[model samples]
Target: MFTFLMMLLLFVPIGITVDLAEKVGKMLENDVPFGEIAFYYLDFTVYFANLLFPLFLFLSVIWFTSKLANNTEIVAFLSSGVSFSRFLRPYMIGASIVAGFALFLGMYLAPIASQGFNEFKFKYLKKNKSVQQTKDVYQQINDHDYIYVSNFIPKTKSGLNFTYEHFEGNELKYKIFADRISYVEKDSAYKLTTYLKRSFDNGIETVEKETQKTVQFPFELEDLTPVEYAAETKSYGELLDFIAAEKRRGSPNIGRYEVVKLKKWSLPVSIFILTIIAVAVSSIKRRGGMGVNLAFGIAIAMIYVFFDKVFGVMAEQSNFPAIVAVWFPNVIFGILAIYLLQNAKR
Candidate 1:
């Protein structure tokens, strides 16, 4: 725990400093207030902490165990008739504690921090790039109503080539079409341009057309336009409901959201996997002392991170199953941990 805290202290500030340096110009250009800037940094600290959590645990374990090996403590302990399995008990307990904390962060705290962090980023650093906009969206507002938009823009609360269909018992009751549809805040209603409404009743059709019209709809802009990183900013329960709703809406970002959802659980499991690997690799005494163990552990950590990012990208950018992308690193490292533990037993 002490080593973990030390690693956290060492790395978080460095991350904050590097980020501040890069974003300082943007903050100044946007004329952001001092308080908001400070709050953004705090959010960024949480974001980075959650991001580098596994690396932090991995390195801390390597450092602590390597020092013990360098000082001959590991040899002394083993020579005193403590089996390797017995020696691993305390490390497992420590890993459980860290894993619980990481789980809490992923499930709850990280979402709040992510919201603040991403909000500040898109608000200041990358203006006019709202995540709530998408192209060619189709959604079922209810069993009886459907809507589509060729392009939806949240900033203006408007859409192009908007179409709405009302159905009753597998029959189209009416359909509405508009060249443009927009929400009017003052009136709490929708304004449609080049509007046309067609109703069908017992094979008799009635058509109503207008250049412009004001009307009410059963849905709101928020229902149609979800933020791209909405998954990251939602609690576990909320994310599950959100994912279900998105699935109902035929959202194209299912893979990306699934990856985020799975990682919340997978990260805690990874803590145990990494801890075992660290102890196994560092428990053996070497002529080069702790240096060799530290180097080897760092390399493994980097490779783990590389695999995680590559697989995560594949899941986000393609139809690859998110479960595989999220769990593959843990499986590979779990195997490594087993192999190293067996060798250390000798």
Candidate 2:
């Protein structure tokens, strides 16, 4: 617990300091209010810590066990007829408790914090950028409907060069075009400028044009933009529902959303796997004392993080299965932990 607290103090402050250093200029330039900045940092704390929880937990385990090895406590316990597996029971129990807390954090608290964190970053620190795709936005809204926007601005909930197509089987039923489109919050509809519609019936085509029009579509304007980053802003149930809704729209980001959703659960499983690896790696004495074990643990942690990012990218960018991408690290590390534990048993 002491080591875990130390690790928390070590990582959180360093992260906050570096982030504030980089973003303070933006805050001043934007004239961001004091209360909003304070709340932003509060959310930043949870968002930052949740991302690196596994590393901190892993290091704390290594630090605690390494001290036991350096003090000959592990030797004393082994010589006292305590089986290796028996010695691991308390650690596993502790890991389970911690894992539960990690689950609560990722599922509930992190989403709330992440929403605030990302919103503040986009609103103040990243004014020149957007959370959603800003150009060539296109999607199949449903089985027979498709939508396109030459460009979009999420901040204004508006787009340019908007087009919507409806098909009857392989043939076009109708198509609509607009020079500009914007969501009307008060009316709960879309306002299209230079609106034009064409319909095909039998062997004839009809055209209609309007200078301005208010229309309703089966989709929301927010649905037109990229929503992978939005996944983290939703709670557990909300995320699942959002993914399901996005899937029906033939969203290309389904894989990415699934990655985010699965990652929440995967984190808890990793706590157990990392705990085993830490204990096994650090419970054996070495000539360099605790420092050697810590060095090795840090190296392993780096490798684990590398593996994680590689798979996460694959899942997000390609057809790689999100479940495999999320759980593969835990599975690989779980095997390593077993091997290391066997060696330590000898």
For model 2, the stretches where C-alpha displacement exceeds 4 angstroms are: 142-144, 155-157, 167-172, 184-188, 202-204, 226-228
Query: Residue 119, candidate 2: how far off, in angstroms?
Result: 0.6
- The residue-by-residue lDDT of candidate 1 on 1-346, one tens digit each, is 8999999999888988898899889889999999989999898888878877878988999999999998999999999999999999998999899889889999999999999989988999999677774798888887788899999888788989999999999999999999999999998889999999999999999999999999998887777787888899999999999899888767778999999999999999999999999999999888988889999999999899999999999999899999999999999999999999999999
Candidate 1 ranges beyond 4 A from true positions: none
Of candidate 2, the 10-residue stretch with the lowest lDDT total is: 220-229
Give RMSD (Å) of candidate 2 vs. truth. 2.2
Model 2: how far residue 140 lies from native, Å: 4.0
Task: Please give the distance, in angstroms, between residue 12's alpha carbon in candidate 2 and its true position after superposition.
Answer: 1.4
lDDT of candidate 2 over 28-147, digit per residue (tens): 989999999899989999987887777888899999999999999999999999999999998888788878888999999999999899988888987777778678877887789999
Pick the TM-score winner.
1
What's model 1's overall lDDT?
0.91
